[model samples]
Target: MNHRSDLETDGEPDFDNVNRSESECLVGWDDDNDPLKPSNWSNARKVKNIAPLVYCSFLTPLGSTMFAPAIEQVTKSFDSTNSLLSSFSVSVWILGYFVGPLFLAPLSEMHGRFPVYMVCNALFVVFNVATAVAPSLPALIVFRFLAGMFGGCPLVVGAGTLGDLIKPLNRGKVIALWSISVILGPIIGPIAGGYMGETVGWRWICWTLSIAAGFGAVVAFIFQEETYPLILLQRKAARLRKETGDSSLRAAAKPERNAAQIFARSIIRPLRLLFLSPIVSLLSLYQGVMYGYLYLLFTTFPTVFRNRYGFSAGSIGLVYIGLGVGSGISVPIVGFVMDHTAKSVIRKGRELNPEHRLIPLLPVCFCMPIGLFWYGWAAEAKTHWVVPILGTVFVGMGINTLIMCAMTYLIDAHPLYEASAAAAGAATRSLIGAVLPLAGTSMYEALGLGWGNSLLGFLALIMCPLPWFFYKYGGRIRTNPQFQLKL
Candidate 1:
């Protein structure tokens, strides 16, 4: 282990000396001296560190899509028009997520991670309970949106939490585990929701999610610790000053700002970056379109299977299993390939930068277009149901890989402002989710399933080369002043 004193000798208090007196000065300590650094944490502690974040990921997705199985019940009880209204129940929550991150991500930076997580999750749990018994469609929508606003915290903050607990070099494995929730949540939600809706009706969807979220909140309260470095340092400075009775001990501390100013800056910074940075804007748009397409497909699946193929609700729900399986398979394979590719490049006397991490996306880009075309056409032609299922499998593989690579690139490109970058991505994606479901029924009706899907596939083909083009040229583009490269 590298020692702190070797890095600096400014006569600041020795924070690395575990045996140092409580009265020692605390401010202006080097990060190398901070034993609380995620890299220095024990293995058991690290597991504890990541567990809540995974739960955070799981909780949000559960809230986002768990109601899919209950969509019919919700629509019928509320006298809804068709799957469109039911789709609204599912997609509207995601819409709230798009809006929440703009401000919430910044709030976490100012207030610390734990408080924001707990408060938001608590709000989610409460509103989720309200959604269970909502007597009217508008009430359901309102409650669901509130729940989503709270649920959105985990998606935005979880990555920052990971950064807090893990170093960049060791992050791949941890990120892979986090990816499981991202991929599996949508699949699992419908599976469980389908069964519960069949047995207990749609009201149980919200009730069940509320129960699960309540449990997760309890676990989080007990296990999750504050991980923001600045907040931790501030705490250390306060403790040392109190112990030593030295007014001048705080050398690195800055005057505290009011909440209004903090909130203003936190809310505005992402918007500023969104307008100023071409890379962020383009990437956000790309991710938004992809996410919109996913929700659109989700809305279409039930109609295709239930009306055309004549599958039972239970069986239709089982179709999502193919997506879950495909995503699960991709996670480990992608992780291994990413590691292998990086090592291979290094062995050839070339250092792999963040842009190099995007190489896997090239294959995914082609896979997505092909998979979309296969699924759309197979479903339209009413070919063997197996063919469409296989197409879904390919779609899953492509989506998982694209998400993994895109997110990795975002993090690598903006290590200092990852939360903001991720927020921007989430905002665009959520907006699409909110709007796409509303259009799915109309689109399919106007164009018919075969042509509607074919059109999507065609669009994917048009964008297929984007990842490769960026991988080859992103470094040069990032070097431009607008991208905000940390180095």
Candidate 2:
């Protein structure tokens, strides 16, 4: 008899509910207080597990855009002017992110995160080397994509590992910080990437990326622990069997499924959640647009500031610091606001719904367009460069707020299925991030900085209603069988 409920997390069947036929001793944690359990680890130990994971998360997204600052040099080196391919070079790394996890994430569950982290870092180094030494443009593009395909483990697996250690009550601050790392990579990469590409050659970008990944691999090798409960339990069971000479010692009477089945489910579940569930579809599309908008701005910043403001390729990334500053400042403020608001909601004795997470979005969503319109017109008029950069601070604030709101709401709503929901949303966001930036240069060329961004401002404006509408009706929509996705 299994007592599994849709509300339960971890997806492990309830071993306690079933009567054991096995006379052989079953293996579990030594007890609920077991020291070996990741959740039971001390704070310092959990940080040991998280530090390398966060570094990789930061590094991979950094890789996506580090190449952006040098796109022109890459094109020149190849002696090609195919405009689409140039932008594709930068965005295709993100495309690799979208494809990698469908299979690799499940594999991580099978092999554990330490192995995945080490293997991905090794492979990333291999392909980054290949990218640096590429003989042709096509070869360059293919190598970068392959690096990304293996390199996305950090994005897909990091949060799950955090969950393994930190319960939901204490997760917000750490997660917010970790989440910043993912966004930080893009913002931080250009500052280094632009200057390096200017001083050295564009190939140096790949060389630097390879070296950075190798460093992260060393950190993971030294510190990362196996955090997956099932895998740890399986290891314990195998150990117990060897010592006790009891072949029937088992982790759970039955595991979820074999590796193949788990892989198939991992690949299929996010797609199903994304397309079949309306709540997922809306929030994912909303988050996807926000992610795409950020990447588009990143890809075009060099062109926009360089052509209009007479910035050099090296110095153009400085404008991106406006975004970095904004997000950095927004993190603590958003964290405080979210924490305070949740406490207030609890005081009222009202039923908590995932929609409660949307409360912050009411004031936060409008900030983006304000930044867009302000920055666009200011830059278009050639006002002091400071004016446009200041406008981006507001845009940065909005982007961080919106992403956190959507992600938190999805996690709260899905409970046991949060990983699937996040994967669905992340895949959509990465897909859009990859495709949207390809349009950035052309959109600016046709409309000029002011109208092109004003167009985006309008898009942002239309999306502002999402949080409000969902806050009121999201619970009902989520519970409606018509909107629910079944495995």
Candidate 3:
């Protein structure tokens, strides 16, 4: 587990350096002047590095829900009277999220993070602009789908980049900052979209998002540097060859598989893990259910506030502030608990294993069921609005904890293939995002808010013990022959 920056030494270039290449050289051979390494960077510069990742996280989730408030406007403009079709305008982007990560995650592994990030984000920007100007509903849906496909890159790649810069011991805090965007962006977007759609028109929602994304792109170009270890190593290997006049310098850590082989394996690995590895299967199922529930809540919030509470569209958006607030409160707490628990477990003489990291999730697992029950029963009873909002707070806390623990565990389990492991998780969750919202309206209408949400909570209660089960048995499960082959 050598740090990526530790691979380089400042001696006369080993002309005969058969073990280095330009890309590999760039990563490990840190010069005093290497501005790319976050450790070698100034405080201001490190903040600048982190800023784009935060922005990227914000943009992706913002894009996911920005159109929710505008669904009515889009349906009216398109002259389509179907409610399902209208819902499609918002949910279809999530469909793109499902598709993009499968390929983009692998591409980042092959090409380096910066190139994939820039290209995919640029594609997102272009389609977002198109979405703003779409003349017809079909065109709008098409553009949104494409924009989402591109936007998915940031969600997967951002974690990989963070992994590159921060060691495991220091990652929790940095990851908490990164997680803020994911937690808050969905909650905030609808608030803005509600106001923007009501006042300026739904098209302006796209325009506003595009403008923000464009600014993010510019910031990323200026501040973000390549952080993938393999790509950096290749760069270093090339530099050494030039300096020492050695044509044979090669990266010590080249991928054993060639391009074609890597591509094939990348495409196949996620599927294999899903079916063959209980650890991946269980985690993916948990993450998917959580994400599905989140989207279901997002789709129903407008209806609950507008019809039941007589809130205007803009005011309905403001209610999302509760969700955002709850998530914000959870970030620091989860980060602290996660890091503290990890350290404490090691101190207690247990093996210094990542399974210990899963301990903090126990509270979140219990809280999820309680929150859902409170929300469902309270809303059904027509209690004060604050009761349901309190339930939402519990939900937010549970979601954040689940996500942080699941991802960290995956990264720990498969450090060699973190990008792919993350992609597998993202793929399952995004599919849930795409499908759950389409059914949300129907469920809420039939079951009413109280029972509909209670059902979700009960399911969570049943699943609450899942992480603990895995924590106790996961290391043995991971050692199975089938799991080893997938890894």
TM-score of each: 0.88, 0.94, 0.87
Model 2: per-residue Cα lDDT over 1-487, one tens digit each: 3323222355333333213454744556665567867777999999998999888888888888888888888899999897788888888888998898888788777777778878888898899999999998888989989888888888878877887888657886787778878878988888888898889978998999999898988889899889877677778788878997878877754345787877888888888989888888998998888888888888878777887888877887688998888788777777787778888878998767788888878888999999999989999999988899999999898988888888889989987788888889889988998899889888888999899999999999999998999998898898998876776
The 10-residue segment with the lowest total lDDT in model 3: 6-15
Judged by lDDT relative to the true structure, which candidate is superior, 1 or 2? 2
Find the 10 residues in a row with the least total lDDT in model 2. Answer: 11-20
Prediction 1 TM-score vs. true: 0.88
lDDT of 2: 0.83
Candidates sorted on TM-score, descending: 2, 1, 3
lDDT score, residue 362, model 1? 79
Q: What are the per-model C-alpha RMSD values against the true structure?
A: 4.6, 2.4, 4.5
**Pairing residues by index, what is the TM-score of model 2?**
0.94
lDDT per residue for candidate 3 within 175-235, as digits (tens), equals: 7778767777898899998988888998889999898888888889888888775676678
Clashes of each: 0, 0, 25
lDDT of each: 0.74, 0.83, 0.76
TM-score for candidate 3, residues paired by index: 0.87
Best by TM-score, which number?
2
